[model samples]
Target: MDDKKIEKRIMVPDNLDVQIDDKRITIKGPRGQISKDFSDPRFSKRISIGRSGNEISIVADSNEKKIRSLCGTIAAHARNMIGGATSGYKYKMKVFYTHFPITISVKDKEVQIRNFVGEKGARTARIIGNAEVNVGKDELEIVGVSIEDVGQTAANIEQACKITKRDRRVFQDGVYLTGKYLETGERIKG
Candidate 1:
């Protein structure tokens, strides 16, 4: 039987500090600190993560596609953590409505959507992690040290006002993502 294992390695930058404990990883940098728990049981036993002399490594028991994919995912997550800790992430959203004006507000770690498509009550979306949500008259901004948390919070806000049981052709009232800004000064518009 030929036994071969797949391994992925990440070089820790000089400005970033990493800590790994069991299934959790924490990264600290100039921007802030981001900690995540990779406790999923699917690959916990088959995969291992460790660090040595400014380098982090992920090793899988086998070279199977699934194992390889998981290793890649974990590596990507680590990269994101490092990037977020260094530069941070920003997501911009715009409120659009044809009939009734929409209002957005953030309070108590929750985003509240009022008068969405003329709804009687308000719809709320929970803010994940330590993401900072800024609600403006027509613009919404989410900023966080973790890309996943900021992006997920933006998605949750965008999905909160999903139009349903209405004519899709006529009623186009909803929140939409307008742009994304990364630490590298790259801008993405949609």
Candidate 2:
């Protein structure tokens, strides 16, 4: 017997309360607000904002069903963006200094990883997609509309601390990803 799972897409609002100013839409939410500039007219682009009690809603739209789903996902993401911007999203990373004190810094368009366990030289880490990583003390915040970008960037940061030549059990000193915030899923870490 073939086991198949049926997936269904949820419905989203068609209308939204959009504040237009300087070619950008300021989408206000229950907790906070987010904005995006209107740049594409040729492509199927749509947005809606509405108020319900203390909560404000934002939504995205396209021509196709897949596109609509994507739009709804983006709208939901925008909601989270506003929420995170107001409440803040914090990602915790532990720096294991068993080998050398690892120093991380964001330079130009990439994150530079240096001095891993007193190594002779430092290594470099690449930040994929368009994620904004703000490093504070030992916590790194990966914030963006696309959750995948933030996750990939975080993974890049964590992977940069890996030492291949050393023993896995004894020399486990590296930057580790502790948490991630999802807009539509349960805990993702295993």
Candidate 3:
């Protein structure tokens, strides 16, 4: 007997729209739009992504474990893209210092960390994509339609404040991600 096809589907909400073309998927909603290239050779061979009857689907030609796994991964990415287009993503980070007060600012698509742990000069983290970075006195808010962009931007900020060659117990000065939220104002974690 021939192998049965394996597939995963994501229901498209009425308010949002999805478009697939040439190994790329674009999701658009009221909040914003996000497009991702799913053109990786490994994934392209095992899975095919398309839309049918108000749903997005990833289909695997074979029931092999690897093929099914790849289909699942593609489906998850599509779901995230749709969710992000509709609700977006938010990340909150806090600045903590023991030796010196840290100053943070956003300028020219970059986050500048100044006076961090008594540093002499400013260190900068490049902001990725269209993600917005709002630097408060001791807190930061990163928001964007793409989860990857928002998360990577947050990582950049946190990494910029990383203390090296210092005792972790005493020199515990850094920016930490405290909470995450969806654009609907629902907190994911804290």
* lDDT by candidate, in order shown: 0.87, 0.56, 0.87
User: Where is model 2 more than 4 Å wrong at Cα?
Assistant: 1-7, 13-90, 182-190
* Per-residue lDDT of candidate 3, residues 34-69 (tens digit): 988878776677678888989988887888887777
12 in model 1: Cα distance from truth in Å? Answer: 2.0
Q: Return the lDDT, model 1, position 118.
A: 83
TM-score of each: 0.90, 0.53, 0.94
Error of 1 at 122 (Å): 1.2
**Which parts of model 3 have CA positions greater than 4 angstroms off?**
43-45
Top candidate on TM-score is 3
| Order of quality (TM-score) | 3, 1, 2
The true-structure Cα RMSD of candidate 3 reads 1.7
Please give, for residues 1-190, the per-residue lDDT of candidate 2 as tens digits. 1132222222222333335453354654433345665344543345444444444444444345544554455455555445433443434465666646677788866887777777766666777655677776656666654444667777888877777877888888777877765433334444
Cα displacement (angstroms), candidate 3, residue 71, comes to 1.0
Worst 10 residues of 2 by lDDT: 1-10
